[model samples]
Target chain A: MTGPHGYSKDKDAHLKRLRRIEGQIRGLQRMVEEDVYCIDILTQVSASTKALQSFALQLLEEHLRHCVAHAVERGGPEVDAKVAEATAAIARLLRT
Target chain B: MTGPHGYSKDKDAHLKRLRRIEGQIRGLQRMVEEDVYCIDILTQVSASTKALQSFALQLLEEHLRHCVAHAVERGGPEVDAKVAEATAAIARLLRT
Candidate 1:
């Protein structure tokens, strides 16, 4: 059976957020397709961008706790590599 | 014991790719700081965008195989939720 860290818990919450984001994305798509004002499209784009960044941050947190921590327990160069890689990914997400 | 699906596997390669992308990101930052031409910055931005897209694609593949597939096996509404969530994430990544 799966525990809290087993990717089962919290999935429903994630899905709801994703569905909302999906709606936002479709709205953006329609904005582009319908030749909306440039500033309006840009504003929607910025909102969508923030939504995606937030989502990435959430995923990064889960990955760090469940994936990276689990990998570190194995004790090897690979653990260090994963830490570095995940950190870099987080940094990249923050940079954008 | 860790198996092939464990996060440890393939980490080093991901780190190396991340480091290269980090260097590219830093370069972009420098360009912005130096007030480089707008087009030049935009071009670098596009490159970095593509790099991120590629990295996200790779991570999505791993997440699908290890995370989503594993979640599906446990059998619950949560499992379907996770699959839908991950699929939605991949779709968003592709859209951008």
Candidate 2:
């Protein structure tokens, strides 16, 4: 299930984390349905958000350490493209 | 910047949060470059990860509340499409 960056090494771990996040989202929905207090629901929402972001950062780190590093070592147009792609991804994530 | 969801109301806030995340990532790179203790680096990584996840969850919530809800209200094939799209997105985020 790896992408072009070959991040599949930790694929299982990533999936597990994501499944938990899905659960968290479901919980948030239920909380809303049950008319939970605003602050309490927001708190859980915060927790869920943190969990997802943590997963993203770890994925990004692996991409940098493995894919980007190898591309840099190869040293050519691919390197420029990889760097640009990674930078753009970072920009996108920040905007997100 | 808002996309179809018209999430522009909080665009400034999202951008600000993302800028902070960009700084955190940069700080992480510096930490690795400086050979910071592995445990300490991991701790900071955890913090940064949490921050990013929080952002994502919030974004998803907004997408569901504003975008998906509106689509559902319209009541047509687009409603199903929007729900499917959102579900697929959740699946992707979880896999990530």
Candidate 3:
């Protein structure tokens, strides 16, 4: 049997994006090490942040479409739990 | 004058969260190098993914509240551009 939510169909894509983000992080480190201008470093940081955010948003959509949608279709306590889980997730995201 | 979006008020919080995520990424790399069990690694990956998503969501909310909202208030081509920019971002996130 599969684990709680099974495996994501887009797992590979997610990993690839993460690896790229890792590289970006290293790039950011190098920029800092080289004493890049304050605004320039900030700009790179913003871009890296956006890339990571994009990756996260894609995963959230997948979770909702696959895990959450599947749990919702089953219709039981799992449905409530899954909905709560997603709601909690969204709440965390919205939290400042 | 400030750059396109000026600067985020919660910039420090965002940086802190991203730094935490960098640690998590490092932890994942260690898990892999150590040759942890497949399922265990996958589980950790899932958790990291969620954490990153939460960070991104928070940033997106901030962009909407500050950048997008400010653009709308100003009213011009900038408003259209900002709306389009946010829409493109959302679309990117939604992509499977």
**Candidate 2 vs. true structure, TM-score:** 0.49
Q: Arrange candidates, best TM-score first.
A: 3, 2, 1
TM-score of chain B of 3: 0.84
- Give the alpha carbon lDDT tens digit for every residue of A2-35 in model 1: 4566344678987888898899999988988999
- TM-score of model 3 vs. true structure: 0.52
Fnat of candidates, each listed = 0.00, 0.02, 0.02
Q: Could you give the CAPRI-style class of model 2?
A: incorrect
Report the lDDT of model 1 for residue A73: 49
Of candidates 3 and 2, the better by DockQ: 3
Which clashing pairs does model 2 show? A49-B53, A49-B54, A50-B50, A50-B53, A50-B54, A52-B53, A53-B52, A53-B53, A54-B49
lDDT of 2 by residue, B1-96 (tens): 124343446656665765665566556555544544333444555565566567667767887887778878888889887777767666654543
Per-candidate TM equals: 0.45, 0.49, 0.52
Selected candidate, larger TM-score, 2 vs 3: 3
TM-score values for chain B across all models? 0.75, 0.87, 0.84
Tell me the DockQ of each model, to 2 decimals. 0.05, 0.04, 0.07
The alpha-carbon lDDT assigned to residue A65 of candidate 1 equals 50
